[model samples]
Target: MKKLINKLLVNHSLIYKLFLYIATIILVVYLFPKGGQFKYEFQKGKPWQYENYYAPFDFAIQKTETEIENEKQQITQNSKHFFEYNEEIVERVKNEVTQKSTEVFQNSELSQEEKLDLNTRIATILATIYQYGYIEASSESKIEKAAITLRKGNKIEEIQPYKLFTSSQILNFLNSKIGTQPYTEVQNQLLNILYDAIKPNVSFDEVFTQKTLEENLNKISYTKGLVSENERIILKGDIVEGENLRVLNSIKNEFESQIWSKSNYNWIVFGYTILVALAFLMLFLFLRKYRLDIFENNNKVTFIFFNIILIVLLITIIVKYDAQYVYVAPIVILPLVLKAFFDARLGLFSHVLTVLLLGFIVPNSFEFIFLQIIAGIVTILTISELYKRANLFISVLQITFVYFIAYFAFSIIQEGNASNLNWEKFLYFALNGAATLFVLPLIYIFERLFGLISDESLKELSNTNSKLLRELAEKAPGTFQHSLQVANLAEASANEIHANAMLVRTGALYHDIGKMDNPMYFTENQSTNVNPHNELTPRDSAHIIINHIIKGVELAKKHHLPDRIIDFIRTHHGTSLVYYFYKKEEEYTGEDVDESYFQYPGPIPFSKETAILMMCDAVEAASKSIKEPTAQAFDALVEKIVNKQMEDGQFMNADITFKELQIIKKVLKKKLKNIYHLRIEYPE
Candidate 1:
């Protein structure tokens, strides 16, 4: 069973597609009978049964009322004993003042003046009650009359009432009575006064009058029963007569019977899915027409595998996110990235197909889908011809502006209000724009790992990494100088042809790397004294000269330079003969030497850039052999060499047409003529 599972899961053959088809058929079978499976539901019934589950209008109204009632009840409960504790504290203080006044007035050891003064103080305290609307008492207020007023006054009615005080005020009042005094004796007297005046109000009859816990619980139960009764009344259904019951049963029976019937709606989804898949496949084919050549080279399998990974990644994104915005990310970035590394028409076609698929997958809203397509089309168009990182950055900025405008357009259409303008929306726009910026570098990395070269790769190749150039300088100075001249000449011609000039220049720099293996055999490194070729036959010298092209290709492969650079090394010499040695052989042998042995391995240039490099290499070498430099001589030399290559079919495989080749030759001639022009004589 495990082995079967592994085969089903891991196999990528046609059997897996068959398994997927069967699984999808089973899923459709199960899902079709489940009503509302893909539709929105507003009510819960059986776990999978369809019912509208929206909150009813009556329920919403009742919910609002219930919340309001709960809030009012909370307020009432909180205020129930809010003032009771404050009343008790005030009564206790009044009683204490009365008892202390009586004790002071009745003391016989006191002088008559002191007794009169105490009596006057008590009278003054009692008189001030009308002015303050409450009896203000102090430590000395203990006369019998004041005690009578406190004991007899009604606790709820006669006490000078104040609103409930907070806990902090009560503690402050108590502390004032015992300031700097031991609190033990003072507390006992205060407790005695509290017991006499307030304890009566707090007894079983007065303080325990509120409802008990059991009573409140019973009330809650009765209230809940009443609410249930109300709900039952509202939702109640009436029994039907015999004929009505038969009609109702007939309707339900029809619904259950039709639940699993064949659906044109499901067919629509399946048909659209198949159409989208075919459209994308066509787009892939259209974009890769040039890829037929690559495919013929036995790399088709790798190419197919790479595209399969891209398709899977796109599909996974659609399934996992299922958001309208998410679909845009892949469609916008993937096509442009494909164009950058592969071909442009394919990118455009892929973008169109991606938009179509997104429309099907997220069928409801067109606003987000339209915005995404616009952003994607603009971004891809902006970066379509980019060949440098700075160009990419500028393109990203342009895309960001387009994205901002697209998002704002969406907001305007969705809300029909300009007030939606705010920093948050701007922030979201900027963040999404930044996300698009991040996608470019990631696409670069993905292409790199797949053995695909992008504009970034060409730019890096153009830059002379100091370390590698230094190695070339130390080991092969003559090859280094030759490479530099070739780079300058090729770069100029490439610019004229509108090819990738950087790639052309960089390829020229390393094209002769293999010449370093036998530096003296090449004329560039030979000293006037050392003539190794003098002892060898002309055929032997020619063979050694042509071997450098093969050797350079081998060294290039070892260093893992991309196929673009490798092609430069192979084709820069084309099938052109080593003319000097060929002439030498003709003179010495007096017989036709096999020209094939003297030619560089003969798969000629395959691109405009390579063809230009080939032209530059020949012209630069021929210029070095010129005894006298002159504008007419330089022009004649360039024209003769290019015309010879054209007649010999060296440019046949290259994409450059005769018109572009002519332009390249003219540009090279003009440059070389200037370089060889005689300096004007200055009057002495």
Candidate 2:
């Protein structure tokens, strides 16, 4: 069990990576829409490029969305309205009138016979109002309906609303009923009484009417016709329009709908899993072959996979809700963000792979994949110097424009006319462009979450007035100035070698922070030329010199600087000896000494940028030591120092080549000559 545990513990990072890949693949596969792909691709007005196709089985020719929408609209226009004639309300109102009649007419100066006549008139009007039906017409949605269905008890009748005495017309109808005679006070009183007593018996039954409307709509067939088995769908080179388009769409529906069978479902998912895994596998291989540092760093690898999954999950949810908005997913943000954190090549590669995986789910796989990959390419190529806000905004705007142009071209090709292009899709592109601007904040968030660094952070750290740098400057002004010179030299060399110049420059600025703790111990900070080293033994002096590397690392951590910047402090001297102190000790003792005491403990530089810092740091510090600063002397100094470091194999771990080293050497030599006011020598 112990041996097994040990074995399992070994290659922990490799284990984590494998798990991440498998988990990513599984999650992406599950997010995919559960459907089989239609083999043939066709569009309206476009010629069918496939060979002559025939129906494999009989299938209903389903209507297009436009056709379905049109049918639904027609149904809505023609559907009848149903109302329930509430007889109970009419009875209640009539009972109230009857009970109050005696009280109301008691004050009237009328004979008993006249009262009887007035009561009979009231009863007659009540019967008439209920018989014809009075509705609150304003509550009805359709004001000009030709007819409405009235349900009273178990009986149903169709009647015109316009012909009925509506609630709005109650007063006019009552006044007209008291007709033609000059209006008497008693008649006017009775008219007002009737108006108060009459209630709308016919009320719109929204629930029942909607139910009936839904039933009618449901009865409408979605499929207009059927294509028989072995029917030819379309001949090769024939335009897919009219009947041909409908038939092809019917077959596609049949194929997609048939994916419900367990066998087919499993098989389809299996195929999807394979394709998704392959895309991720290609990404892994790319990282391993080209970006081994990122490949080895599990956090960065997880960060990449997290972005891919996040994008997929976002688009999947959007597609599940409404596939029409899938294009608005801001797919270009992936490339933009990755490029900010990593490099352009990695960013573009990851974007293409992610887009390809999305192709499995988004509608119009070819078009979506093509547009996203193009936009991603645009993102990687056009966007640079992401520390600048204007650059990101401008690049995003250009990316949006590319999306529009490509989509318009595709639409024109498919429809064979620009006039038929859908304008709504342009809104989606605009939204996609807008969403891409969120990459700025997202990069910052990822930077914090993954403990990663980006150009923006580098720029912020490169400021000379930052807290840590300021402390270094005030405590050891000479070392701070030395750091600035080294920073400039490293930056120039890095630009020449096509490495990350900003990262190296920032790293160079903070490399000497350890010298701040013991300012007088370093030669640069020794203002009075007080020989402190002369009072101490050679070994103790060497210990103090070698101790700076260790102290720098601690100071960097205390300052919460990014590991990338701290790397310069750690590896600037590598494992090379403090030769001046070591040689002095050896000359005094004249005996063998433990060489380790004179050396800075190091992992050395492990990347091109770090390697460039190492070279620049050594060259800059050594260049200041030259009393007779001549062009040839500087040249020889650069060559001899760089050659010795190379002989010591300090850069063996770094991912830099001899050609790049030579270029960096030339840059440093020219910079050193320019610094000392010596003219650069030209080849004769």
Which candidate tops TM-score? 2
- Candidate 2 local lDDT, 166-265, one digit each (tens): 7667777677676446877777777777777878777777798799889988988889888899988889999999889888887887876674789878
- Whole-model lDDT per candidate: 0.58, 0.87
Cα error, residue 493 of model 2, in Å, equals 1.3
Candidate 1 lDDT over 330-369, as tens digits, reads 3456566766665565555656655554443342325445
Estimate TM-scores for all models.
0.62, 0.93
Error of 2 at 310 (Å): 2.2
What lDDT score goes with residue 616 in model 1?
Answer: 89
